[model samples]
Target: MKVVVQVKLTPSPEVATALEATLRSCNDAANWLSLRAQDREEDRDRTRKALQSFAYAELKARGLSAQPALHVIRKVADAYSTRKANLKAGNYGRKDSKRYQRIADNPVRFRADAAQSYDDRCLSWQYDAGTVSIWTTAGRIRGVPFVGLPGAVKTLAEYRRGETDLVHRDGIWCLIATCEVPAADLNTEPDGFLGVDLGIANIATTSDEGEPFAGEKLNKYRRRQIRIRAELQARGTRSAKRKLKKRACREARHATHINHVISKRIVAAAERTGRGIGLEDLTGIRERVRFAKPQRVALHSWAFAQLAAFVKYKAARAGVPFVQVDPAYTSQMCSWCGHTEKANRPTQELFACRSCGVVAHADHNAARNIAVRAEHVWAAVNQPHAADTSGAPAASAAPQGSRS
Candidate 1:
């Protein structure tokens, strides 16, 4: 239930310069590390360590406490190791994605440290405004110029009782907040399980019920992305390189904003129904979908992992149940008669359940089936315990455990 509230920082000119200098120092360390590694003039590990030490000194000089250089060095080394493995696997191209290649070549960059200003938590900042300063911590960061906080800051109680995270992108920061106010009691109890099918085409679908949500707006945003990609690809010049970076930032902002909205709606609907949430056990979905490049890209872009994460945390806050069932037959099985076969879904949209002759939207039927399955799981797991009149776990509900 822990949540983080990312408040925007409005630093003075001096603070802005200091912050930029710190970031550049780390970036330079990365550059120098790469050069040293390529030249083979110094031990790659030793050179990286030296660069990290310098970055740490820079932070100390700025009066902003940061983690020891070794801490950052380890992180960078890990990233480099992982990326190098990816490169060797041939999943990534060199010239086509120079940025990634560079990152793979040199991974370590910066580190964080506990500071009193941010409640003794690691402080990090980018794109600092001379007049405004924003930072994050377990609690609020005070003493900053602003038109008040950009968004509402949650109290400690609220933070500890809900799901939240602080993610940064494009130099502009955000506090991805989730507040779960109690909803009116559901009128009709969920009769059975509801199967959820997640994919690129419709985003999410429930069995029996229609698609609770479709990312049509997001599709429009993707169109803009295509145009931006086309324009960037067409130029292939220095200016285009700069524009490409900006385009990446713009795309990230749009996607985050849209995702926040979509996650909230989807989770809220499940809570309102007072039913368990079901999701496909998308373990290794990427590998399974790799045959179709465009499909892989779309599925990856949708980031169903993030969505499922949101659903999980929100469900816990609402005292609802969630389950990850086998995705193998969830889609292929006919929701009406339990006829589990691929032929049941002959077309993408049409689902004429041959055994029961139930014709419906393919995805919707899948979702309904998922939900129904989840309910059975809930009953099985909690049947031994007495159900409270409120239909929620008792007052001594255990802490919501994470999925790995």
Candidate 2:
């Protein structure tokens, strides 16, 4: 498994200047390559090679490294490839086509790649000494102080040193180290599954034991931020604009931290019980559902996608199976009797099935359905031929209840 651990760096004035120069040079090189590649669209390899050879001596004279320049070329190539793919997919007719066209016309901005540009030969970390030696434009910066080395990061350092990204954000320099860890002994034949229903009211509800993870706190915080942002924007002053930017960053960090915590607990719960985790496949949900203006804003701002991504990575690291089932009727269908009806979910919180006369919390009902769906999927894939004496798939025996 690959994971990134970010450690804060404290660099001297001279070292900071060198780092900034190196990043600027890399960005310039990337922009140059992007423009050249567009002109020689039919001959990508030739253009890249020619640009590399031409920029090598010039970049070296500017105290920049060769690896970073090459990395920039790769980044530009990837961007162009993505644009071409989108164009071929007929996305050129979309509103974002103008944005794509602008990219084609201008130089691509190069974001610093801490790992790709890192000269392994020139970079070294002394974990016990709390220092890192890195290559920079002005020369080698030795014994740069780094703080807050998490226990997990220390373990990864012991195993192997991978690529690290040096990012400069909001006047802070941080090193993001990507490390590879050994895979866990996954329960391939998981006894069952823990279903998780993601939403705005209840962030996550599992099929197994424990109360729902409430999102009220987060929702209230987000709404407060929204109101503050609106008030600041109304002023349209320099200070308000600056405060808005800072507020945006603060909100993002807070939400991200919450997602990490939620995902970690959910994955841990499944691992503890030796069961897999199941989730709804909510791709393109925004396009599928319609809502009023206020509700639309809430739905649009909801971090469902971010939550799902966090859960996926955490589950993978723990060797827990994560299954995503179609979410079409998972919310409306009765989890007890498999009865499908829109009337079953008359309210947002309550689910009362007409066919089975079963009553349960809507989110809990949906989570149970997700769990059963995952079981059915797992059985179909792993035990295709395994059947009970009644000649039915073993998955049919899955418990049909809201709390399952």
Candidate 3:
């Protein structure tokens, strides 16, 4: 399992200046190489080797040491590769579309404060002392004090590998290091599943007697943020713009913290219950559903993907068996008697099954449905080759290795 640990650097004024200069120099070089990449792409020869051969010598002469210059070349190459992939994936619409043409015509440009990658040779961590020794244009700066969560620092110290990225965002300097953490063995042959249903009204609802993470507070906060943003936009001043940026970041952090809390609790419950975790595969949901302008604002404001991602990684790390099932009729279908009807849901909060005469919370009923389908999906996938996979109704799990 790969995880990222971030630490903020507290450096002297001189050290900060040197860091700023280093970033500017690297990005300036990158912009220069970006144009070269565009020309090479035009020539139908956009290989990294070709660009390195042509530009590496000049970059060294242009005041970049060696690794930084090489990184600049690779970064530009990666940007172009990403652009190409996005184009191929039809992310920018058709070839004749303006969005596609604009992207294809423009060259990749790196901002001065954009993140720069540093290998082990250029950056060294002193986790015990909470300091780092990093290479800058001014030379190797040692004893740059840093701060991070104690657990994160410990993980970085023990499992940190590969490159660390130095990112400058909102006037803050932080280093994000990649750590290769070992995942626990998956819990095969689970007794049952802890089903989770995600939604806007309730952030998460569980099937185990219904633990609902309400989104009322978050929705109120978002509404407040929206009003403040509207007021700030009306001002159209520099300070207002700055405040908007800060508020945007604050809102995102608040939502992210809430998601982390919710995901941790759900994963912990599954681990303690001796059960697997089941979830709905909500891929392409936004594209599949349309809403009015006001509803769209509410729907798109929250980070559904981030929440799901947190649950998945946490579940994997805890050795809890996890599976996602098709969510075609989880809400409409009755968990008691497998009854499917629109009238089963009398209200947003109530589910009255006509067939089974079972009354339950709408979210709880949906969660139970998801759990049943996930169990069947997991069994079908784990069954022997001769076993009929098509036996499970309205159930299909994503392909995965035996160990997840």
Prediction 3 TM-score vs. true: 0.93
RMSD of each: 10.1, 3.7, 5.4
* 1 against 2, candidate with superior lDDT: 2
1 versus 3: better TM-score goes to = 3
List candidate 2 stretches off by more than 4 Å: 41-47, 90-100, 111-116, 159-161, 387-404
Q: Write the per-residue lDDT of candidate 1 for residues 15-109, one digit (tens) a residue.
A: 44444454445444444444444444343554456556545565445333354233334434555556557777766776459866675555344
**Cα error, candidate 3, residue 95 (Å):** 1.0
Deviating ranges (above 4 Å) for candidate 3 = 42-44, 384-404
TM-score of each: 0.64, 0.87, 0.93
Candidate 1 local lDDT, residue 350:
75
lDDT, residue 100, model 3: 95
lDDT of candidate 3? Answer: 0.84
| Candidate number with the higher lDDT (1 or 3) | 3
Quote the positional error of residue 127 for candidate 1 in Å: 21
Model 1 weakest lDDT span, ten residues long:
111-120
Clashes of 3: 0
